[model samples]
Structures are given as structure tokens and as C-alpha cells.
Target: MAQESKPWYRSQTKVGVVLLAGSAILATVGGWLTGSISMANAVVALIAEVGALKLAFGIRDWPVINRNK
Candidate 1:
């Protein structure tokens, strides 16, 4: 088996890392503005947080349903 050679600067992972940081900052600022974090806002932020995870670590392509072939 051979490994793929690529440049570090143009990596997709790098972009995802940047986006994750941005989302974290936004959530922090939002919580600060509201004086206290509430369940609703926390839920929304959680979703964004998970989405960022998917972006940073690419999701697997698993079939949603089983097909009877």
C-alpha cells in the first residue's frame, strides 16, 4: 500500500478546524450576551457543535436503508 502525498496548507482538515474554532467562539459570545445559558440555546449550539465535528472529521458514507437485491 502507498500513502498519498499532499500539501498541508490546502488541507480540508485545516479549513474545518478554523470553522470549529469560529463556531465555539460564537456559542461562547452568545451565552455571555444572554447573561446565562438556557436549554434552548444550548441545544442549538450543541447541534452546531456536532456539525462542526462532522466537518472536521469527515463522516462515513453508510447506507441509510438496506436494499433487497
Candidate 2:
């Protein structure tokens, strides 16, 4: 029997990478285009980055659903 491959969204590492990249772009754009960085914005960005990292590194084995085997 052939094994199935997991979807990209199911991979925590992939999700984390995308989240981190998005947060970085937001921070850079917010800082560069506005010429000002707010503490609130920085805090939010930090939270997102850290959360993504935590989710990626801290979790193993994705949750599965079953219908009576």
C-alpha cells in the first residue's frame, strides 16, 4: 500500500515559516513607509513571530479524526 502525503497546511513548520515571513514583511513595511514604529505594533509582531515559532517547534503529531475503525 502507498502512503499518503500530508498537505502543506497540515505541516506546522510550513505554517510557522509563512507566519514569520508575513509578520516580518508587515513590520518592515510599517517601519519603512511610515517612518515610525509604534510599541503596540512591535508587540503584536513579536507575539505573532514567537507564537509561530512555539507552534512549530513545540507541537508534534497533528490531531487526527477517526470514524470507528
Candidate 3:
């Protein structure tokens, strides 16, 4: 039997979680400092956060995995 070492970049899950948490913190701080939460800003932030999470999680496209042989 043989074992292969995983690369550091393979820790997508951890990266995603960290990014998500950071996004949340940023959003909260922005809202607090501005004393107002703009819908547009919120939406943009949400989208960016989601995109980052997806990228961090190694999601490049739809379906998450290829089904075709």
C-alpha cells in the first residue's frame, strides 16, 4: 500500500470557514460604523462572501462533481 501526502492548498474547507467568518465580521463592523445597513452593500458583501467561500471550497462549477465518464 502507498500513501500520498496532501498539499496545503487542499485545506479548502478550513479556508472557506475562515473566509466566511471574516466576511461576517466585516459586515457587522461596517454596519455598526455606518449606523445603517444598505441593502445593496449587504447584497454585494453577501455575494462576495459566497463567492470566496465557493472558491475556497474548491468549487469551480456546478454539480460540485463531474458525473460523466
Residue 23, candidate 2: alpha-carbon lDDT: 74
| TM-scores, one per candidate | 0.41, 0.43, 0.45
Name the lDDT of candidate 1.
0.61
Model 3 TM-score, all chains together: 0.45
Q: What is the lDDT of candidate 3?
A: 0.62
What lDDT does candidate 3 reach at residue 20?
Answer: 70
Please list the residue runs of candidate 2 whose C-alpha ends up more than 4 Å from where it truly belongs after superposition: 1-4, 36-69
Measure candidate 3: CA RMSD: 6.3
lDDT of 2 by residue, 1-69 (tens): 954456657877787687776778677567856868776777776677767755664444243333321
Candidate lDDT (C-alpha), each: 0.61, 0.63, 0.62
For model 1, what is the error of residue 42's alpha carbon versus the real structure, in angstroms, after optimal superposition?
Answer: 0.5
Worst 10 residues of 1 by lDDT: 60-69
Q: Could you tell me the TM-score of candidate 1?
A: 0.41
Query: RMSDs, each prediction?
Result: 8.0, 8.8, 6.3
Candidate that scores best on TM-score? 3
Clashes of each: 0, 0, 0
- Tens-digit lDDT track for model 3 on 1-69? 843345534667655576676778587558856868776777777677766656654542324473431
Q: Which order, best to worst by TM-score?
A: 3, 2, 1
Candidate 1 residues lying further than 4 Å off, grouped into runs, are 1-35, 61-69
